[model samples]
Target chain A: MTGPDSSRIYTAALLIIGDEILSGRTQDANLAYLAKWLGVQGIRLKEVRVVSDDMAAIGDAVNALRTSYDYLFTTGGIGPTHDDITVDAIAAALGVPVIVHPDAQAILAGYYGDKLTDARLRMARTPQGASLIENPRTKAPGIRVGNIFIMAGVPAITQGMLAALDGVLPGGAPVLSRTIAAWTQESTVAATLGAVEKAHDGVQIGSYPFWRDGRTGANFVIRATDPAMLATVASALMAALQAIGIDPVDGEL
Target chain B: MTGPDSSRIYTAALLIIGDEILSGRTQDANLAYLAKWLGVQGIRLKEVRVVSDDMAAIGDAVNALRTSYDYLFTTGGIGPTHDDITVDAIAAALGVPVIVHPDAQAILAGYYGDKLTDARLRMARTPQGASLIENPRTKAPGIRVGNIFIMAGVPAITQGMLAALDGVLPGGAPVLSRTIAAWTQESTVAATLGAVEKAHDGVQIGSYPFWRDGRTGANFVIRATDPAMLATVASALMAALQAIGIDPVDGEL
Candidate 1:
């Protein structure tokens, strides 16, 4: 249950908005991208929430999560469709007025000439003081207000924007990890594992079970703030596993 | 964003409790599996929440989502580990005492004999009057009370217990779907797509982007409560795509 001691860790939470996703019509692809990417950069993903596009629900969720966490990421319900209400929800959450982003309108103006009707321009709407996140997926861009970034639900669009912003976002100290995919049961290595955890106070040891090509095995990942300490525990773990007649494949994950 | 319109549509939310996941030490596979499965059966996955194994957070999330949605599902914090506080959280949320389940105790007793110490036996604990969901992954089971179903975060066990409880639970009418996939920019057929959507009042026509092996395409799926309407709209969508000289790939998502 150990988390990164973020004296001011750039903590983030995700609030996924869409009834299509909630109804399971669309499988959300943003959670893993955010979680894994944030992990490497040391901006620990504190929490994640997936909610329907209902305005009340969305407003309540956004306000609650955004106020609590340092950063809040919202995906979906910002498209040019009747069901898209993320803009309204964001404004409602902040008790501000929703208005069209002049820059977003400019982005679309060049592409569609006069063909960009009211329906299409609807995507340009944003809450007060929100900045646009340039989207390569579609002309309609995502918006960021304070630390809350609202992005498209589509995986490609979300991933694209996140990649573009990853290096720029203020981050906590980066984490380093090493793992050994060991062919053994968890119980067999429990004692040594406990000792390793006890010795490395700053590191967290996690064991994940995976069925590899029809065979059952476990991946023992030792993570730490310090790379040197991680390697030390990793070396000890590999030796302990080998001593117990279990072969481990060392790899970085 | 159109969820199934049915009184039987059981709105469910997930409260995932585990620092292992939040710390990026674990990748949660349960949320998607449960969400997708529930969608097919017409049980709406209203929300999903991931929080660390903190008693206060877990308790708060359990109380919140449970009150908001028709059903609540929790995972990851009910284990033999010392940090597992799902039982305590559930108790705190429900304002009830947690007691050991006889069924769970029997299951654990058969496996561990005298080795089933207090730490191990702790798995038997559940909020008062809650029923246990049998775990195929481990001896430690999950609990359910007042529409809240708590299960292990591990995929196999969650799926197994969900399957086991399928018949006992009520569900909305299953959603019927029809899909058309082929090479077409969503913008290219926006007008016609909108027309199709307007005509098919009962059916929902959704355009999804797909790129595989460098070939770009879009999958337009028509979903509705009525099977015949879904088929009709799907056929019309295919005809329109073909009429525009757009060759659609063969498949459904």
Candidate 2:
């Protein structure tokens, strides 16, 4: 437990804040993008919570997840509207006061110029002592306080903010994966997958079954931190599937 | 806080269990479908948690959510693969022993006949004192223990399970919504939207902004339980947008 490798397992949680998402009116597009982006940063996204634009809901979830992971990120409810209460909720969660960040104010002022009203000025609010994450797509910046990062809900703005933070945070080894697919039921190869995973020390095999063209098929994704281990497990799994009279494809079918 | 309408404000939480979703290997198609389905059942999906297949992770999320809402619906991790640990994890969460549900066993046996092996038999396991939710598509039934529902990961299988559960659970008044879109910045109309929402009781207005074809636009979605109230709020919102000199469309742009 005290090994140096223990520190290599960095994890984060995302809190998606919007009524639109929970209402099924807006399909969330941020989770997969952030998950893949965090993977490239060697940080595993261990959990995600989608909550509506309620203060106590956001505050409770923020506190619960912020302490449980290496970092906590929130998206949505940071815009100028009254429903945009993320900054206030997060500030209350951290027992800090919401303040107008001068840098954010200046950025908004420059972007909007004469059109900047008090409503637009609401974008400058953040938790006390928080810094800003630049949004190249939008002038209003994202907020960062302690281990919690508050981002925009818009996919493109979120992407821009994520790009601004690339290689900025410390991370661990990026997890690698190899996929093997077959036009057979996952239940048919369940035992083989279990045995192969148990035989390997640090490999995880995930079975995703699908039905296409009136045929049942599955993709077996083997994930490991070490490239050599991943390659070895891939070969072993391919051999096992072949032995069962199923032709396995190297990538997804 | 105790009122005649209190009982009619039903709410639920969703727990999504899978590593494929957390790793970005698979985009979740279940949340939107379940959200809309639950909406039609008059259950407001209040919060959703997506966690990995790890036992402690799943167990913690289940307990945290089950007690907080009227119902808790979980999707994924009910398959036959070794990584399919939702049943055991949920049993641990409920502080109950895992038992082979007799009905589930019979169904799987009837479906697989001679092909039913040990791995396939694992689908028959459920928490002690659990009932079955019928899966019309796949023979392996979903599980219902107390207030928690354990359903399949596949979108189609989950849909079949939900169809089986139609009119089964007691729900309240279904929430209705009206959308008004305009080719204007959300910030430009944020104040008007806020005022309109404040004027209308029992209505929540959500502002979702978008950028398309080099122009910024936003959609205001007004939700209420009463159709009359919903229409009134929608009309007020549309008038407010128009007063701001933005042409409001009846639906999403």
Candidate 3:
């Protein structure tokens, strides 16, 4: 197994909380968004768990992941509804009380005016001593409780909150990647791929098979912390595919 | 916290294994498909975890989830490629040795004929004391080892394997659901929704908010094991929305 250099590697875990996602009513959009963003920031997304809108589950996952990773992010259950118990759950996990942030109250009060009901006031609540992540798309800001960053369930709003959080966390060297898509079956070139991966130091190759236009093929993704080795791996992969009489495409299909 | 009837409610946890999924290189299609399929089988998908294609991580997740739930389903890393180490991981988790099942070998032989290469033979491998889940779409079949179902990463192949294993697992009650979409923001009617949910027994209302065409609204999903309670809860939710002067639309908008 190819292991990361532990001393410099930054990692994160995302806890996606919602019954809608578990019930198949909603497809989670935040994982991919956060994964790509973290990758660019040179922080590896280590694990992702989608738990239902249950308090104990959320609390347990928060406690487990927050301590295990460099950073922990949670999406969903921050809304102004009965099921939105993320704040309470995190407080329980952190051994703290949920408190209303005056700044959050002012933001919601200005946004909704007379419509700022008690339910809306729920959005201002967070674990004690926690700061806030700015929600550029809405009045309710995302809560930052210790290492955990709790954001909205809505994709657009989560994106805005993530934007506000860009370049905030420290990270290591960004993972460099190059994709080689071949119009040939992956199994046919499996040994070649493995051999190439073994020959290269500090490089990992991932083969993703897909069926498109009534044809089956695979995309070889070469990833490494060192950018210089990516070309060597790519060239070897292309040559290997060609040796097997496959025409490799430069990018993903 | 509302606990399920321990004797009757069958729970499941999915461990999606792949570096591609963790790297955000591939959008997972198996979790939702399996969740809905398992719901129809009366099994509640309680939790889902996406882990990288690493041995220790896969082994830990398989061990934890298999013991925690009635059944555990894992997708990805079952293909005939270098990254496909799900079988080996599961075997180590079960304290068993990796072996090539004769039945699986025969099945692949029949499917691939003379084209069954050494790489293709990798698909015939599974843990000892395991049965095979038929794959009508391709040569490689899914493995059923103890409580864990090891499946392919490819979406179509995974679907075929799932279809083959459908109606095979013992389950309790099929959860029925009804959705009521309201053109009002969720916070405006959050209190009423919670009240309606509290009044209803054996029913769970999930509020999913969405913004479309400059309009903000929410879809309230009411779920219950009893089909009769679904109608009752739907009517009450409709009445609640109406009392708040918000027009509720039938089904999802």
* Complex DockQ per candidate: 0.35, 0.83, 0.78
Which TM-score does chain B of candidate 3 obtain?
0.94
Predicted model with the maximum DockQ: 2
Residues A145-171, candidate 3, lDDT per residue (tens digit)? 888899999999999999998878888
Worst window of 10 by summed lDDT in candidate 3 chain A: A1-10
Best by TM-score: 2
lDDT of 1 by residue, A149-188 (tens): 9998888889888877866776777666787776654545
lDDT of each: 0.76, 0.91, 0.90
Please provide TM-scores, in order, for all candidate models, with all chains considered together: 0.81, 0.96, 0.95
> Lowest-lDDT window of 10 residues in candidate 2 chain A?
A1-10
True-vs-predicted CA distance for residue A40, candidate 3, Å: 1.1
lDDT of 1 by residue, B1-253 (tens): 1234464556678888776677655667787788877766667677888887678888888888889887788877565544556888889888999888899899989988987777677788888988888777666777888888988877787888888676566667666766777775455665667777788886666666656777656666666877788877877877877887877654663
lDDT of 2 at B4: 33
Q: What local lDDT does model 1 show for residue B157?
A: 78
lDDT sort, best first = 2, 3, 1
lDDT head-to-head 1 vs 3, winner: 3
